[model samples]
Target: MANPVQFLSQVRDQAAKITWPTRREVVTTTIMVFIMATLAAIFFFLVDIAIRTGLTWLLGSVS
Candidate 1:
């Protein structure tokens, strides 16, 4: 079994090497992700409406 103290020391050493993002950077990234997601949702909604309208017209013409 591994020693607990040795494992904790290794964890601490690895943590020290990490470069964490600042609060500003985190907020900016989050906003950009949300904006992109919203745009994608709108684009897919338009596509779905177009497909539905086209199918409706095709079926109506055949009937």
Candidate 2:
């Protein structure tokens, strides 16, 4: 096993190197994610409706 003290020192050094995003960047990215997710949900909903309608018509016409 490695030395505990040395391991702790290395962990601290690595942690210090991290560059966190600015508040503005975080807000902008979060907003973009929400917008994209909404668009995707709408698109899928429309596609599902179209498929269901097509299937219903096809099955009904066969009767």
Predicted model with the maximum TM-score: 2
Candidate lDDT (C-alpha), each: 0.98, 0.98
TM-score of each: 0.85, 0.94
- Which tens-of-lDDT digit does each residue in 1-63 have in candidate 2? 669999999999999999999999999999999999999999999999999999999999999
Clashing pairs in 1: none
For candidate 1, what is the lDDT? Answer: 0.98
RMSD for each of the candidates: 1.3, 0.8
At residue 28, give the lDDT of candidate 2: 100
Off by over 4 Å in 2: none
Q: Assess candidate 2 and give its lDDT.
A: 0.98
Sequence-dependent TM-score of model 2: 0.94
